[model samples]
Target: MDTPGPRRLAGRVWIVPGDPDPENIRGSVAVVADDSGSVVVDAGQSPAHAREIQSAIRAAGLPPARWLVYTHHHWDHVWGACAWPDVEIVGHVSGQEILRREAARPWSHRYLRDEVRANPRLGPSFRARALAMQGWDDFTILPPGRTFTDELTLPTGVRLRHVGGAHAPDSTVALVPDSKVALLGDCFYPPPAHLRAPDDGPDLAMVRDLLSDDYEWYVDSHGEPTTLEQARRLVST
Candidate 1:
């Protein structure tokens, strides 16, 4: 609800921040535009979120993104790809496998049932909303037609790199050469211990390797966007 857009990154680049409390919404979506067209890094969690992103896109005076780069295979970032069905999707091979197995599945309803079975206090509203947001009838999971092991030159004027981090398996980091902004999906920091133990699951060494002084800013799905200098310090800590 924090005025979704016109949040400039550098020049024609901007960020459409996700719902900070995206228990039911989507993740932060990054956008970069040029003469060729615009590109988005990660969609949100539901069709409603996607529609919001679309509004932001139009308000930005930008065309629909030519491509969608999933930061990882998590539902929060990739589920909303349905909103931009024409955009060419990009992600990792392992993540493709996940899409094949789980995308469009009744995974949301299944999870909800599990929760309600354990705790009746959850009530029906939560279940109803979850199902609706899951985009049941037209729900989909689009595997990146273009797969990469390490790096690739994306059509969207981004140097895409497969940055394996403490997050999910198919993490990608996009660096806008002209703007000097790095759009890194949720590949930093660990989830709270209450949600999941601090696995420190990402490859910090890989992260440090990816973190160079060239980028001016690093964008993630949540939290304050960090600068290259600041992110290096945070990584060390």
Candidate 2:
């Protein structure tokens, strides 16, 4: 399938939809434009993908992305940080530890393949998907430069709250209060079976708590944008 461009969501917000292809799982990237500039959520899976998002953001006539925020430290959600050296990166404090650890690991194809072979249960799917993408020569992982604890409100009024769950202990939710849009990342999904993750699924209670807010739309990293009613139904199930 041809890669799609960023689609507008609410006032000053747009999403570069994710590709669910088994071999190349690209997570969605959200952009919130404010007077200062664009606040992007998730740098994407690769530098190439991040470049596409940057191009799309420019094409949409939104300001250049001044801030790149990570919902978690997962590779699919942040490996593209290398592409935005000029943008300030933001993430949960806990995610910094994970990214630091990831930075130490050798990301070469052979090393990754060997690691996957030796510890096949951990993240074979992630390895397979990453390997399928083009150019691993410059595939560098970077930790966030600026970290936050419970919550942070950007200068633009985009609020970020740490709402960790089963998917990731450092998972966060980005809320554009004025726009009534929330970017939920992959926090609502259960861990992949291959990882043998101990937790059953995301904290639905915390997720449900979000429904009490005034968000009109909820977007998961790999799914279509959903209305409040649709989001409620999803959380219930």
Q: Estimate each model's TM-score.
A: 0.83, 0.92
| Native-to-model Cα distance after best TM-score fit, residue 34 in candidate 2, in Å | 1.7
Clashing pairs in 1: 18-28, 165-202, 166-202
Assess candidate 1 and give its lDDT. 0.73
Give a tens-digit lDDT track for model 1, residues 104-167: 4665676667876886655353453475473467777777787889888876668888766556
In order, candidate lDDTs are 0.73, 0.83
Give candidate 1's error at residue 3 in angstroms: 6.9
Give candidate 1 regions above 4 Å deviation. Answer: 1-3, 22-25, 107-111, 115-135, 191-195, 198-206
Best by lDDT: 2
Per-residue lDDT for 101-122 in model 2, tens only?
A: 9988877667767777887774
Cα distance off (Å), candidate 2, residue 154: 0.7
Clashing pairs for model 2 are none
Give candidate 1's error at residue 156 in angstroms: 3.2
Model 1 clashes, total count: 3
**Model 2 misplaced stretches (Cα beyond 4 Å):** 122-124, 197-199
